[model samples]
Target: MIGWRLSGALVASGVLLALWWLWGANARLSDDLAAERAARLAAERSAVLARRVAEDEARAQLQGERLNVELKRAAIGRSDPVPDYLLDHLRGLGVVQ
Candidate 1:
């Protein structure tokens, strides 16, 4: 009878210890999942910002090119014949009919 009681106590203690370890592992995994989610959100935000910056740069470059074409046109007015290079540039910009 005493031996049976001792064995029962040992089994119960082992089960309790296993439960405690499982709880700790679950908490650690939850923390890791939360950290991964945060990192993904941060990366998404950075990608959006990078795309905006690239778009702005492209817009600025296009505006600069258009301004240069206008200056070239003004420098050689209606009285002068348009140079072949300038005509090609205007055609490339879809400005020449």
Candidate 2:
């Protein structure tokens, strides 16, 4: 009877330890998955932000080119006799002063 009780206790302790170890492993797996998801989201957001910044930079460059063209046209027009079209454009820009 004593031997039987001792064997039962040992078996119970082994099962309990195994269950604890499995639970710890499950917890670790859950944490790793969560971390991976967060990293993926951060990367996706960063990619989107980078794309938006590039688009903004392109728009700004186009605007700068447009302004430079307008300035050159105005400068050339001013050096010559003003035509109706150039006078109208200067009026539109409120540069009559």
Candidate 3:
């Protein structure tokens, strides 16, 4: 009878110890997961910011190209001859006949 009681107590203590260890491990794993999630969010934000900057730079480049085209047109003066396509269209309408 005494042996039975002693064995029961030993089994209960082992079960309690196992539960405590499992709880600690779970808490540690949760902390690590939270840290990883935070790092990912930060990285994503940086990537988004980089993309916005790239888009802005591309828009600026397009604007510069348009300015250069306008400058070239101005340098050529407004005395340029009319396009042949325009003359054909006007002749078709009898305006240039």
Top candidate (TM-score):
2
Score every model by TM-score.
Answer: 0.59, 0.71, 0.60
> Model-by-model lDDT, in order?
0.84, 0.82, 0.80
Which is the winner by lDDT between candidate 2 and candidate 3?
Answer: 2
Highest lDDT: give the candidate number: 1
Better of 1 and 2 by lDDT: 1
Q: Which of 2 and 3 is ahead in TM-score?
A: 2
Which residue ranges in model 1 land beyond 4 Å of their true spot? 73-97
lDDT of 3 at 10: 99
Task: Please give, for residues 1-97, the per-residue lDDT of candidate 1 as tens digits.
Answer: 9999999999999999999999999999999999999999999999999999999989977886875676577667834556779778867976554
Ranking by TM-score: 2, 3, 1
Clash count in backbone of candidate 1: 0
Q: Relative to the unseen true structure, what is the C-alpha lDDT of residue 75 in candidate 1, on a scale of 0 to 100?
A: 62
Give me candidate 3's TM-score against the actual structure: 0.60
